[model samples]
Target chain A: MAFASALKCRECGREYPTDPLNVCEFCFGPLEVAYDYEAISRAISRERIQNGPLTMWRYQDLLPVDGDHAVDLQTGFTPLMKAPNLGRLLGLDHLYIKNDAVNPTNSFKDRVVSVASTKALEYEFKTLACASTGNLAGSVAAHAARAGMNAYIFIPADLERGKVVGAAIYGPTLVAINGSYDDVNRLCSELADTYPWAFVNINMRPYYAEGSKTLGYEVAEQLGWQAPAHCIVPSASGSMFTKIWKGLKEFEDLELIPKVHTHMHMTQAAGCAPIAEAYEAGVTRVRPVKPNSIAKSLAIGNPADGYYSLKTIQESDGDATIVPEDEVVAGIQMLAENEGIFTETAGGVVISGLKRLVERGAIKRDEVTVAYITGNGLKTLEAVEDTVRSVTIDPTTSSFEEQVLNA
Target chain B: MGVTVRIPAPLRRVTNDQDRVEVDAENLADMVDAMEEQFPGIKERLIDETGSLRHFVNIYVNGEDVQFLQGLETAIKASDEVSIVPAVAGG
Candidate 1:
């Protein structure tokens, strides 16, 4: 059942009908997808949700779209594994990893793109488009292909080669702007105003943002209907971070989770850690940065939801921190080595930030923690290209034994 | 009460196609008043009737967001450059 009632501004109390609108016309605040909780409680139950499809649509009551179509690549409902190995290594008793790299487009961006494209169809937009740092571009293109709509993706010219190829392979018109992700986004904003295309994170952002709620819902459900003590998520535009918090609150409000006290930590590359910087300084506003991190995907200098993300973290009693580039690479290696989960640079930020917190005792040893891995490692081979190397030896048992033992 | 206002491309008409304009104001609120004095309708684009900065419009003083410093009460130094940039999104 579709329970989304209207799109409401997050800042001001004004509301608008459920339309392809992202901002409040009056105060120009970001719009959020609002649902009638009374209707949702009557429409859905724990058993009903568990008995539904394994995809993200299982929480259709929480999302904006109907379950029949518009867009669905079987995204979400990803593996929520108990990382006993990583936990032992980090000296934490209970730790889990929300590995979203297994999505169809190989990142959590698929979750947002799916709902955005579907909402776009509802709005009768002929084209799906976005200005992305990296991951969203590929997801938008892939979903557009599946929905049989024209896709136009704009991205920074110097993004990872794999990500560029990833979007281009999906048959989208990829435009590479000659500047930072901020520059690309500025151009896309202008284009969004002029063109009739549904810029997913712009025109359809209220719905696009709702899809990330499924992550929080899935985590609690997978944990047998209880929220974790700590959760670390990578932040760029900070939309995903804020939505995940709303998702957990919605679950508790709907009685899916008895109560939620999850402390939401935010991770960022130090090169582009505006939100983290604000958080550490005990400030409310985020000062923009010129991004210069290997984690290009999470390198939005001026994150749109930066202030709100900081608010969520602070209100949840969570800490926000920045990871150096070297630590980011170490993080990717640590996760792969300990948990066998290869993740992109954003995941690197999360994993590394998690490690830093654990090391500093910010996250206690006994806390039930969850680290979100948002993208695949294949998208960022350049990050580990220098640190990870291969020693080629002759295809002989003697050479194999000697080299293997020596190393 | 003198400060430089950096306008973005879209709102260039507020400054007569000039990217940067010198405005006389002691704080952001005064600056908004000074701007509206020159350009009739551009102030609405920057702030709402309730006098809060527009969510889409970002005002930075010396590279720091005004909401962090003191909102409209943030002190405006003669050397400080105030830039009005729109919020960028997507990924």
Candidate 2:
């Protein structure tokens, strides 16, 4: 049985039944899935989770879905390895990388889409739709294909070619709008009212967002049932950043962990860093900006959870950093060269923001820090296409040595 | 044809369950005023105390956001279709 009890409004503290509703009718605030923790505490344990499935469904007790026949694709339980090479270079001792890029769809969006798709089926919805920047489009389409549902994926027209092809490969009805991600989201909101399809990120968001807590669950469990000292995550809509922290705290509340003092740091590209800018200005109001960044995946200017993310950062005593557009490529190169992990622009923002935080003394040298790498580099080849250098030589030993080796 | 304003589901209660209302107004500001005059308490929800559009409320004129146009002063023709949509939480 699912432990989720109600969908509660984040702002007005209003509660409603666990339906496919994201926004509160009265306050217009986001509705979050509120679980029956007392029952979950009795049902879940370390031994139970360890004995569960190897995928994200292992934390099914904490998630909002009933995991009878989930829309699984071997999504989560990604590697959490110590990054000594990256750590030593960044002047740190205890540094690890939560490599979520190795997921089925090559991004962390799979986790949420997996849960959302399962919930959509439970609600008897035939169509799965979403307004994606890039990664989510691919994830939602893949899940819809697995569930045998019709998929309608919408995105900004100028998205990455790899991401567009990635979603299209699943045979979803991909619509590319000639505007920004925010514009596409607004249009989808209107469409959600007219259609009976389940928009994963819109109508099904209350349950969709609960899937991110598995990241936190895995991190703590992989670390021998203890929360790390610091967690640096990439922020777009700020949902994942806040949910990761929420996962850690939920474990603490359930007596699964002693206590979580993890500092949640958020990173963003300078071109579209509204949450980071709000945190920097010591305010709760996030002023939206026109996105102009190479990190198109993290280019949501008007973030929905910007206010709550700021509140999470302040509550956790965490910091937010913005990476310059030029340094984004450098950050990607840094991780690739140092740790042999080729990550996309969002990961680059995390690594670059990590450097800034370390340089500014916000993160101590010996603290346990886990840097989240959310996407694979293959999807964003254009961001680092200029860094490629190839030599043209004939099939001769002498020509190879002279052109490639000597040069 | 007149300026037809489409009310979102949340604000339909104030409009007496009327999904669409025909209002005679020149611009967005006058439209909000007319809506308040008809609905009695909707202006406070659409516009904040500072007299600016609330952050969570979006006003679209013929599928174009008013923020992209002249905002409150955006001229409205008689045949325009206005929609008041609530901002969605991100994906």
Candidate 3:
């Protein structure tokens, strides 16, 4: 049975029956799935969760779906690695890495797309659609293919070729908008109004967003059912930051863990850091900016969830910071060199922001901190190409050793 | 709080997809409340029931986020501009 109670407007407190709707008709507010938490609390147990699938569906009881229609891409259950070497390099004692680069799409978006596609199937929609930056497009296409649905994905025109190809490989209808992600999103919003397709982040947003909670759930579980003292997450729209906090709170509410004291830190690229700007200015509302960061994955000029990120960070006693482009590149190199992790530009922003926070004495070095790496470096190679050195040598042992190894 | 507010595509349904709207308010809170009254349920998508803004919705007054001003209580003037932006993740 689906544990979902109803769809409730986040602003007006008005509730509606569960359906494929994302916005409220009366108030124009975004709709979220309300659940019978009492029932979920009673049914979901640690033993039960352990026995379930290793993927995100393991917590199906807490999810929105009701049948075998969950679009599964084997997402979630990723590694929460102890970054001993990386931490030591940064002068920290305890640090962890929620490495989502290993996800099927090489990003954390797979987690949300899985849930979105599953809900689309449950809604009996034959076509899947979304307006993505890059990661979500690939994830939606991949999951739509897995679910045997026709996919129509939209993205910005200038996205990385790798991501474009990745989405196209899934045999989806890929459309490139000439403007920024905001323009693509605007077009998708119009399409959502006229078309019956399931735009995951549009009409299926309530469920689509729930997938991110799995990231938080996995981190706590991997940490042996304990919330970290602090979590530094790269924020674009700010959804991931809030969802992680929600996931931890849900665990605490379920008695799966003790009271959650995890302070959430929001990181951003300085070129497009409206949220961080607001945070530093001691504000709650974020003004949109024109994004100009190499970390395009996290370059939402107008973050939908920017306010919440600031609130979460401030309420948790955590802070938000934006890293300059040079620092972002340095951060990417630092992670690659110290932890053997090739993170994308967003990760660079995160790592650099963590360093800034540490330097400002905002984050205690001794605290058990978890830095989330959301995407793989291969997706954003252009950002670090300048710093990544390559040695050209003939196919000879001596030449290879002299040019590459000895260099 | 009397300023013109711009709404993005994702939130157009709440605001008739109209690119912008004029509302009367003194701060982000009043603007949101005013927008909610004019658009109904819109404030919820932008703010939670407890009056706190949602995580994915960003509200800026005159290209300045209220988070740095007075948060919800940031005072606004008729000459200011407000824009509601959601985090667009698809690239």
lDDT over C-alpha atoms for residue A398 of model 2: 97
lDDT per residue (tens digit) for residues B1-91 in model 3:
3598777655677678787889888778888888888888776667666777665554566555555567778888899877665533333
Candidate 2 vs candidate 3: the lDDT winner is: 2
On the 0 to 100 scale, the lDDT of residue B65 in model 1 is: 60
Report iRMS (Å) of candidate 2. 2.1
TM-score quality measure for candidate 1: 0.87
Cα lDDT of all candidates, in order? 0.86, 0.91, 0.82
Q: Write the per-residue lDDT of candidate 3 for residues A1-407, one digit (tens) a residue.
A: 36999989775778988887776554455677899999899899899999988888887887788535677778889888889988987778988999999999899998888888888888889999998888998999999899999999988888887788988999999999878776677567657766889999888888888889988898988889999998999988888898899899999999999999998888988888988999988878677777788888887777766766777887788888878877988989999999999998899988988888888887677888999999999988777777766777798999988888887
TM-score of chain A of each: 0.97, 0.99, 0.96
Candidates ranked, most accurate by TM-score first: 2, 1, 3
Which ranges of candidate 3 are over 4 A from the true structure? A397-407, B1-91
In angstroms and one decimal each, the interface RMSD of every candidate reads 4.3, 2.1, 5.4
Candidate 2: DockQ? 0.48
True contacts kept of each: 0.44, 0.36, 0.26
User: Which candidate do you rate higher for lDDT, 1 or 2?
Assistant: 2
